[model samples]
Target: MKFSTYFNDWLYGQDGYYTKYRTIGKGGDFYTAVSTSKFFGGSIGNKAISTIQSGFLPSDTTIVEVGAHHGYLLADMIEFIYTLQPQLLDTLTFAIVERFPHLQEQQKKYFKESFGDAVKLIHYNNISEIKLDSAFIVANEIFDAFEAELVYTTQEGIRKNVVVTNHQLGFEPCDDLFLNAICDKYGIRQGEIALGYETFAQNLAQNIKKFEFITFDYGEKYPRNDFSTRIYYKHKVFPLFQEELNLNELFGKSDITYDVNFMHLIDSFNQAKIKNVSYQTQLKALVEFGIITLLEILKEKAGESAYLREVQKVKTLLEPTGMGDRFKVAIFRKESHA
Candidate 1:
């Protein structure tokens, strides 16, 4: 079947891919930071709090989170903010923009149980509907979901690869104007193939007027010494699935994701004129924002020897060569005119 057909069939509404993956777990298809540990959420909460306290607050200031899978991070933010300043929690408005209805329903259920009507949960199917203005937008593991167009460079010129045969899943080269435009913008010459993440990044950045944007994912900048793309499957990196992994199989049926292009993201932000850009690994951002302090709180709450072991596991998440380094944090802040 064609990709569009397959995607439509497997990912329609409640009876499709969204519901299928909702049941995933330890032995199931995939896992994210939220699935791994609450520490990730705690660390993000710390950053959000710091951002809010550091002069980004307006009377209408809001926290807009994209890809709020299972509302784990939202719950952490609400709980952490309540602990820090209960008054602010009352003023805080939480908006969750999710694509899938089933996931949005899950978010509603979780928020209703956690905060009742105190937290405002706004669900959206498209990013275009997200209104900006003094909002902090957080997207964890969200960039890789943007559909990428494949391109290959040849001795003659550049060629765009389009799926030609569905049964064999064969790719054929064609001349696509949009792909050519992207190649020109990125200065990709002959004999080079690249993903279209840069274009997606640029589109996302251009849509927002005023907001603090941060993306957490595993990806590298362009002009890499390594020629291979970074893709993960089943909590492990596999080479064979790097280029040909199907989106339906990767996200809907399994836990697979590609590393984002951090340099491209930075460049896109620059082109969009969004200022105060900062890039760090997730671990560094966490430590700089006081994740250790949160762990101490967790330790105090547990007061058990086993909790120390859990702390060690969480510490490993911050190691430079581990998830801490693999996962990056990119932030862009829009200054207010008033």
Candidate 2:
């Protein structure tokens, strides 16, 4: 079976698809930037307002977020916008493209309790359902979750790692339309290449007419030396070889993601006719929006300890030791000026 298909079975299948398992908190498998600190979303709002006021978007601009979990970032973004630009909130749209029913219900409940009729919400089962004319979109840690292909580059060419049924479940060399495209794109090369093998980006581009879409993921065009594909289960990192056939039993319950290959992402947008694309690290993106000023305010009003605590929180998003270099942000817009 295709790796993406396997991912969908676990992430959206009736039994395996869930976020409530030891996930998203102290007892969870992992913590995101939004869960780490309010400042992360707050800083996003600080720039979102500028984007809205810059007169590039329409008055009825819809702000859509894919892979929004529990509405934490949405809540924080709206709150920050409310504090700084309250009037604009009255003329905005909030939409979430989520597949999991549980998370959709949770986000719906949050919006209902928080904004009432003040905000317009449109929920979609997938990005293909989006029919917006223009919008501002934000997706944090979204692209990495897409399925990836583990291919061993041999002297002949690139061979895909596919799941096959032998004695039990084992991996074998398989080729399909998707894998063929990967080999054609990368050409015959030697070395192990973990291609982020999903079409979610292309699907999103084909659906949305024009959007100021932004995605934050971890990956690079080139690697320095050691490159490996691993899985994370409640913060434990294990190689793909270890799981083998048992990957379904293990990773099905946990989050399975891979480092994004931005080249593929950029190519997808270009194919979909999206223009004015740009990229930046999470640290530079946050700093360019000016978060240090916010830190200074906390320092004067609160104690130094509180300020230091805030600094630590900001570091998680900015410091290279953390998500700074690990996470990257890519922006795609319809116009060249934006």
Candidate 3:
């Protein structure tokens, strides 16, 4: 089986480890900016409200969150809108586009306790199923957890990597249109090109009819030095499954994600007729989204003693070498103007 197949199965399969694991936060494999600080989600909310005030997206536009991870981000967003733009809440729709069984349970509980009937839980198995006509779609750390097609480029030529045996995964020469397409698109050099993101982006584009789509992920639009699949368990790198040593990590019990290429994403969206694109670092995006003001509000609510803690929370999301520098935010406006 291919790595994507194995990966999809390991994470979402009925017998998958994610079904039994809480693989997020300080206690889990890794912490996302959303999980690290509630401010991250609140900042997203502020961005949404600002966009609405500026008429980027209509007030009645649906806010669809893809792969929301227990709906924590949406919770923050709902609370922000309630506290600041409560009237907008009545007109707007909060839709959580999710599929994971384990996450759904947690999301349902969170919604019940936090948001009540404010959110519309859309049950979707595929990303395509979660469609929108006019909305603002927030996909935080979404693109990274996707199927990546690994290609090996040698002096001879490009070759697609595949699983040959249980012991080792091997490479097959690039002779097909798929390899040619990727080579033409990304201008692959004599190194390695792992792309399956193109298809993923293209598929997502179809579902987005008209929206301000924002993606937060790690990696560049241009290919740099990236050649490894990451698996984290308890905040450490969990070794990939092998036939030799006993990799105790349960199948899909950890977080398996790869770097995202925003270049590939932009091309895909443009090809699909989505226009008006811009990119920025997470720090910049949050800054532009008014993270400082949001932090002050948090500080006031949490108290001065807790305010410093809130400042650190904001810093964690904005610091270099941590999430700030590593994480990138790409905003694609389907329309050039309101």
Q: Which candidate leads the pack in lDDT? A: 3
Tell me how far the alpha carbon of residue 37 in candidate 2 is from the true structure, in angstroms, after superposition: 1.0
The per-prediction tally of clashing pairs is 1, 1, 1
Off by over 4 Å in 1: 1-19, 23-25, 155-164, 184-209, 223-252, 304-309
Q: Report the number of backbone clashes for model 2.
A: 1
| lDDT tens digits by residue: candidate 3, 54-123 | 9777898888888877788888887887877889988888777776766777888888888676666555
User: Model 3: how far is 44 from its true place, Å?
Assistant: 0.2
TM-score, each model? 0.80, 0.85, 0.88
Structural RMSD, model 3: 3.1
Best TM-score among the predictions, by candidate number:
3
**Residue lDDT tens for model 1, 1-338:** 33333333433424544555354336644556666667777677777777777777553467778878788887877777777667777666778888777688888999999888787777767666765666777888876654444445666764645342432333456566765765676664422233444554455555555678778887765523222333344445554224555544443443323456566567656765676367888888878768788878877887768578767767656888768888888888766552
TM-score of 1: 0.80
Candidate 2 positional error at 34, Å: 1.3
lDDT of the structure predicted as candidate 3: 0.72
Q: lDDT scores for all predictions?
A: 0.63, 0.69, 0.72
